[model samples]
Target chain A: MSLLEVRDLNTFFRTKHGIVKAVNGVSYTVEAGKTLGIVGESGSGKTVSAMSILQLLDTNGFIESGSIKFDGRELTTLTRREMYEIRGNDISVIFQEPMTSLNPVFTVERQVSEPFMVHQGLSKREAALRVLDMLRDVRIPNPEVVTKQYPHQLSGGMRQRVMIAMALACRPRILIADEPSTALDVTIQAQILKLMNDLQEEKGTSIMFITHDLGVVCQMADDVAVMYCGQVVEMAPARTIFGKPQFSHPYTEGLLFSIPRLDTPSDVRLEAIPGAVPHPLKLPDGCKFAPRCKYATERCKVEEPELVEVQPGQGVRCFYPDLKERRKDG
Target chain B: MGKYVLKRLVYIVIVFFVISFLMYALYNLIPTDPARAQLEPMRQQLKPEEYIRMYKQLRKEMGLDDHLVIRYARWMGIIKGLKGKFDGLLQGNFGYSQTFKKPVVQQISEPMKNTIFINIFATIAALGITLPLGVYCAVHKGKKFDTTVQTMSILGYSLPIFIISLIFMYFFVVRWGIFPLMGSKTPNATYEPGSWEAFVDKVYHIALPVIVMTFASLGGMTRYVRSSMIEALGTDYIRTARAKGLREKVVIYSHAWRNALLPIITSILAWFLGIFGGSVIIENTFSLNGMGKLYWTGLNTLDFELVLAIQMFYTVVSLIGSLLIDLSYGIVDPRVRVNK
Candidate 1:
C-alpha cells in the first residue's frame, strides 16, 4: 500500500453567500520515500488538500467527502486526539512564511523539541540534545546559540533553516512543505530548497512539496500534479510533465509559459495568461477551464473531462489531449 | 532603560505641577467663596470686625492671601519639600478637608482602601471569567457555546451597572435574604483573627457589590478577548503550530493566546485603574462606603481640597498602572523591549 493515498477528497468553506468548493474531488498517491509536488495558483486547493490529510482545516472549513489513508490507516476517520499523536510523529508540515510560522514567544530549542516532549515523553535534556543535533543537521552555525535565540532574532534564511530543523526533529515519515520558499529571497530560496532536498535524501523521507513555482518543482519533485479549479488536471513524472506535457489544458500551458527563465532575453515579451482563475463559487458549467481554453468545443462546454490516462506514467483531464493541435490552435 | 525611566519621571513631575496649578486656579474661579461659606454659619456668634479678622487669618493660614503666582510657586515649592507650614521639609501636607474638618490624607486612606479592595476583586473576577470564555467562543466560533456566550455578553453589556446592582440587591438581599444590601460589613462585625465565621461574614457583606461590579465590566472584557483571539488565530503562526501536530490546547493557549493577550492586558490595566478610583454609580447604588462615595460627597459639599486630593491620588495610581503595563509588554511579547 502507498504511504499516503488521497481518494476523491473534497473540501469546502462555508461563506456568507455560498460554499466555496476549495478542493474538488482531488485524488493522488505517494509511495514511501518519494516526493510529490502540487503546483497551482493561490486558490488551487493545494494547501487545503494537505491540511485535510491532517484534519487541520480551520473552523470555517469542512471536508465534504474524502478518504485519506496513510500506511493502511484511514486518516480522515481518526479522532483529533489520535491525529495529534500521528501529526508530529508520522507526518509534519512546514509553512511558507518562516517568520510567522515559528512562535515569537518561544526559543528555537523549545519549538524544535516540542514534538518529542508531547509524543515520545522525552526528558527536557534529551529533547534539548535532539534539538541541537537537528539544528546541526540543517547546517545552522552555532547550534547552541541558535537554539537559545527567539524567532525574530534570526534572519529569514536562518529562520527557514530553523523551521526545517524543527520539522525534521521528530524524524517524521512525511514532510509537507507548503510554499516553504515563497517568502524568501531568490538566493535564499535556492539554498532552502537545496537544504530540503539534502534532508529528504539523508532521511529517505517522503515529501509533499507544495509551491506555485515550476522552477522549484523541477528542482525537487519526483512526481508532479497540476491543479486548477480545485482539481488535479494533470499528473506525471517531473521530467515527463516538464518535457513532454501531453495535456491540452490551457491553464497548465499558461502556467508553464509564465515562468521567466535565465535564457530568456530581457527584451523578449513573456507569454501571459489572458485572465484570472474564475471564482470557484461561479465556476463554469461542464469544464471549469472551458471559458479560458482556446480549444474549447461544444462538447467541452457541455461535458466535464475526466482525469484519464493519456500516456505511460501520465494522466490529464481534457476532452482533447493532443498538444500538437493545441499548439496549432494557439 | 534607565534613561527612558528618568525621562518619564521628569514628565510625571511636570504633569504634577500642571495639575496642582489648575486645581488651585479652578477652585478660586468658582462663584462660591470659601471664606464667605466659613463665616455665614457663624455670623450671629461674632461681630463684623471679628469675622474679617477670622477670614484674614484663615486666608493667611491657607496661603490664599498671597499673589496668585506667588501662591502657586509656594504650593509647588511645598510639594518639592521646600520651606512652608505643616512639615515643609517633606512634600506638601495636602492640607485638610474643609468638609470633614480632618487631614485630607487621613480621611481618604480608609475610602481608598475600600475602593482598591472592591475594584481589584471585581477586575480580577472579570478577567478570570472573560478570558477563557472569550477564547472558548473564538475557538468554537459558531457552536452553541459561542452563541450562548455572545447572547449573554450582549445582555450583560446592555444593562447599566446601577440597574444591575439594584436588581442584584433586590433579589439576593431583599427576597432571598442571602446577603447584605449595604456597607462593607455588618454593624459591630469584628474579626477574631483566626475565626472562620468572622472572615465569612466580612466576605459575605462585600460579595454582592463585587459581583455586581464584576458582571458590569465582564461583557466588555469578553468581547475584547474574543476579538483579539480571533485575530491571533487568523495569523499564520497559529496554522503553523497546528501543522506541527501540537495538541489543540497547546495551539490555542501557547501559540494563539500569548499573542492575543496583548490587547487584553492593556485593557485590563485601563479597567483596573479606572475602577480603582471607583465606579461612582455602582458604589452609590450598593450604598458602599468606598472612594466613589467619598468623591461624590466631596463634590456635593464643594470640598475642593478633598476633591483635588482624591483626583491627584487617582492620577498617581493610573500613572503607576500604566508604567507597570509598559514593563509587562516586554515580558509578554519578545518583540518589544523596555529600552526601546
Candidate 2:
C-alpha cells in the first residue's frame, strides 16, 4: 500500500454566497520512499487538497466526503487527538513563502525544535540539540548561529531551509511540500529542490510535492498528477508526462505548449489554455476541460467523463485524450 | 534602548515645560481668582480700602501679581522660589489648593489612591476577560460565540459611557442597594487604615464604579483585541503552528496569542495609563472622590494649583507611556528590535 492514499476527497469551503467546491473528488497517492507531484495553476485546489490530508483546512472549509488512508489506517475517521498524533509524527508539511511561514517572534531553534518537543516529548534543551542536528541536515552552515537568529534575520533561502528543518525534524514518513520553492529566486529555488530531494533520500521520506512549476515537477517528481478545478485530469510517470507521451490529456498538452521555450523563434507567440478555470461555485456540468478542449463534442458538454486508465499506468479524464486523429469523425 | 529612553526623557522635560507654561498662562487669563473666592466673606466685612489692600497683598503673596513669564519661571523653579525659597515645582513645591484647603501634593493623595484603586481592579478584570475572550473569538470567528460577543460589544461600544454609568447605577445602587450611591469610602466608617477591613470597605464602596468603569470601557478593547488577534491568526505563521499538530490550546495561546499581543501592547498600555486619567462620568455618577471628579471640580472652580499639578502629572505619564510603548515593540517582536 502507498504511504498516504487519498481517495475521492471532496473538500468544500462554506462562504456567505455559497459553498465553494475547492477540492472535488480529488484522489492521488504518495508511495513510500518516492515523490508524487500534484501540479496545477493557482486556485486549482492543490494547496486545499494537501491541507485536507491533515484536516487543517480553514475554519469554513471541511472535508465533505473523503477517505484518506495512511499506512492502512483511515485518517478521515481518526479523532482529533489521533489526527494530531499523526500530523507531526507521520505526516508533516512545508509551506510556501518561508519568510511568512516562520513565526517572527521565535528563534529558529524554537520553531525547528517545537515538533520534537510536542511529538517526542523532549525537553527544550534536548530539542535545541536536535534542532542543530536537523538544521545541519538541511545544509545550513553555521547551524548554531542560524538557530539563535529570528526568521526575519535570515535570508529567504536560509529561511526556506529552516522551514524544511522544522518539517523534517520528527522524521515524518510523508512530507507535503506546498509550493515550497515558488517564492525563492531561481538559484535558491534549485538549491531548495535539491535539498528536499536529498533529505527525502536520506530519511526515506515519501513526499507529496504540490506546485504549479512543471519544470520543478520534471526534476523532482517520480510521478505527476495534473489537477484542474480540484480533480486530477491526468496521472502518469514523470518521464511519460514530460517526455511526450503517445496519448496525453489536452490540458497537459496545453500546459506543456504554454511554456515559452528558448529554442522557439523569438517572434513566435506563447500559447495559453483558452478560458479560465471556471468559478468553483459555477463549474461546468460535464468534462470540466470540455469548454476549452479543441476537440470537445456536444456529448462531451452533456456527460462528464470518468478518469479512465488509458494505458498500463497512466490515467486521463477525457473522451479524446489521444492526439493521433483517434476521433471517429476524422 | 538606553539611548532611546534618555532621548525621550529629555523631550519629556521640554514638552512638559512648554505645556505647563501654556496651562498656567491660560488658567491665569480665566479671570477667576482662587484667593478672591477664599476672601469673599472679608469683602463685605472690611472697609473698601482695607479690603483692597489685603487683596493686593494676598495676590502678591500668591505670586499672581508677577509677570506671566516670571511667574511661570518662578513656579517651575528656574529662579528663586515664590516664598523666597527654591520651593517651585522643580523643588517639590506644588503650592496649595484652595479647593481642598491643603497643600496640592497632600490633597492629591486621596484622589490618586481612589482612582488607582478602582482602575487597577477594572483593568485586571478587563484584561483577564479580554485576552482569552479575544483569542477565542478570533479562533472561532464567524461562529456563535464570536458573533454573539461581537454584537453585544458593538452595543457596548456605541452607547456613551455616561449612559452606561447611569444604567449600572440605577440597577446596582438605586434598585438593588448592593453598593453605596457615591464616595470613595464610607464618610465615617471606623475601620482602621491599612487594616484588611479598611481595604474591604474601600473595595466595597468603589465596587459599583469599578464595574461601571470596566463595562463602559470593555467594548472598545475587546473588539480591538479580537481584531488584532484575527489579523494575527490570519498570518502564515499561525497556519504553520497549527500544521505542527500542537494542541489547540498551545496553538491559540502561545503561537497566535504571541503574534496578536504585539499590536495589542499599545492599546493595553493606553488602557493601563488611562487608570490615572480616571473615568470622569463614572466617578461623578457615583459621586466617587476619584481623580476624574476632582479634576472636573478643579477646572470648574478654577483651582489653579490643583489643575496645574494634575495637568503636569498627565503630561509626564503620557510622555512616559509613549516611550514605554515604543520600547515594548522590541520586546514583543524581534523584527522591530534594534541592536543599538
Candidate 3:
C-alpha cells in the first residue's frame, strides 16, 4: 500500500460571501520515501489540499468529504487526541513563510525541542540536548548558538532551517512542506531545498512538497501533480511531465512553456498562458481551465472532463490528452 | 537593562523634587490660613489679645511664619531641620492634618488600607475574568458564545460606571437585601480587627463595591484581551503551533498567550499600581474610605501637607510603574531592547 493515500477530498471554507470549494475532489498519494510535489499558481488549492490531508484546515475551512489513510489507518475518523498524536509524530507540516512560522517570544530550542517532548515524551532537558543534533541534521552552522537564539535573531534562511529541524525532529513518516523555500533568496532557497531533500533521504520520510515554482519541482519531485482551480489537472512521473511526452493536460503544457529557456530566440517574447484564474465563486461550467486553454473546443467548453489515464501511470483531466495532436492542429 | 533603569531612577528623583516644590508653592498661593482654620472653633473661648498672641504663636510653630521659599526648603529638608532634626517629608514627618487634628501619616493609614483592600479585590476579579473569557472568546471566535459575550460587553461598555454602580446597589442591596448598601464595615458590629470573622465581615460589607468596581472595569478589559488574543491567535506562528500536533490547550495558552500577554502587561501593571489610589466615584458611591475620597477632602480643606504627601505617593508609584512597564516590554517581547 502507498504510505499515505488521500482519496477524493473535498474541502470547503465558509466565508462571508459563500461556501468556497477550496479543495474539490483532489486525490493523490505519497509513496514511501518519495517526493510528490503539488504545483499550482496562488489560490489554486495546492496548500489547501495538503492542509486537508493533515486535517490542518483553518477554523473556517474543513474537510467536507474525504478519506485519508496513513499506515492503513483511516485518518478522518480519529479523535482529536488521536489526531494530535499523529500530527507531529506520524505526519508533520512546515509552512511557506519561515519568517512568521516560528513564535517570536520562544527560543529556537524551545520550539524545535517541543516535538520531541510532545511525541517522544522526552524531558525538557533531554529535548534541549536533542535540538542541537536536529539543527545539525538540517545542516545549520553553529547549532548550539542557534538553539539559544530567538527567531528574530536569526536570518530568514536560518529560520527556515530551524522550521525544517522542528518538523523533522520526531522523525515523522510524512512531511508536508507548503512552499518552504518561497520566502528566501534564490541561494538560500536552493540551500533550504537541498537541506529538505537531504533530511528526507536520511530519515526515509515521504514528502508532500507544495510550491508554485516548477524549476524546484523538476529538481526535487519524484512525481508532479499540476493543480488548477482546486483540482489536479495532470499528475505523472517528473520525467513524463517535464520531458517530451505523448499525453499531457493543456494547462500543464501552458505552465511548462511559460518559462524562458536559454536557447529561445532573443527577439521572441516569452510565452505566457493568457488570462487570470477565474473567480473561484464563479468558476466556469466545463473544464475549469477552458477559459484559458488556447485549443479549447465547443465540447471542452460545454462538458467537464474527468481525470483519465492515457499512458501508463499518467493521468490527465482533458478530453484531448494528446498534446502533440493538439499542437499540430493549432 | 541596568543602565536604562538607572537612568529612569535619576529622572524620577529630579521630577519628584520639582513636583514637590511646585505643590508647596501652589498651596502657598491658596487663600486659606491653616492656623485660622484649625483655631476658629475655639476662638470664642479666648480673650481678644490672648487669641491674637495664640494665633501668631500657632503660625510660627506651624512654619507658616516663614517666606514661601524658606517654608518649601524646610518642608523638603533642603536646608536644615527646624529643631536640629530633619522634620520634613525626607525625615518621614508628613506634617499634620489640621482637619483630622492628627499626624498626616496616621490619618492616612486607614484610608490607604481601605482603598487597597477594595482595589485588590477589584483588580484580581478583573484580571481573572478578562484573561480566560477573552481567550475562550478568541478561540471560539464567531461562535455563539463569542457573539453573546461580545454583544453583552459592548452594551456594558456603553453604560456609564455610575449607572452600573447604582443599578448593582439597587438590585443587590435594596431588592435582594443580600449585601450592605454602603460603608466598608458593618455599623456597631463587633469583631476582632484582624481575625477571620473580621475579614469575612469586611469582605461581605465590601462585596457590592468590589463587584460594582469589577463590573464597571470588566467591559473594556475583556474586549482589550479578546482583540489582543485574536491578533495573536491569527499569526502564522499559531498555525505552526497547531501543526506541531501540540494539544489545543498548549497551542492557545503557551504559544498564543505568551505573545498576547505583551500588550496586556501594560494594562495589568497599570491596574496593579492603581490600587494605591482607589476610584473616587466608586468610593463615594459606596461610602468607602479610599484614598481618592480622602484626597478630595484634603483638597477642599486645603490640607496642603496631606495633599502633598498623597501627591508624592502617586508620583513615586507612577515612576516605578513606568520603569517596570518598559522593562517588562523587553521581558515579554524579545524585540524590545531595554538598555538602548
How do all models score by TM-score?
Answer: 0.91, 0.92, 0.89
Q: What's the true lDDT of residue A149 in model 2? A: 96
Error of 1 at A124 (Å): 1.0
DockQ for all models:
0.67, 0.68, 0.66
- Candidate 3 residues A201-283, lDDT tens each? 78899999999999999989999999999999998999998888999998888888888767768887778999999888988
When 1 and 3 are scored with DockQ, the better candidate is: 1
Off by over 4 Å in 3: B1-75, B78-87, B95-98, B101-103, B188-201, B272-278, B324-331, B335-340
Query: Candidate 3 at residue B236, lDDT?
Result: 95
True contacts kept of each: 0.74, 0.69, 0.76
| Reference-based TM-score, model 3 | 0.89
Model 1 regions lying over 4 Å from their true place: A244-248, A262-268, B1-28, B31-33, B37-58, B67-92, B185-202
Q: Candidate 3 chain A vs. true chain A: TM-score?
A: 0.98
Cα lDDT, model 1, residue B257: 94
Task: Give the range where candidate 2 chain B is weakest over 10 consecutive residues by summed lDDT.
Answer: B272-281
Pairs of residues at least 3 apart in sequence or in different chains that clash in candidate 2: none
Cα deviation at B222, candidate 3, in Å, is: 2.1
TM-score for candidate 2? 0.92
Error of 3 at B200 (Å): 4.5
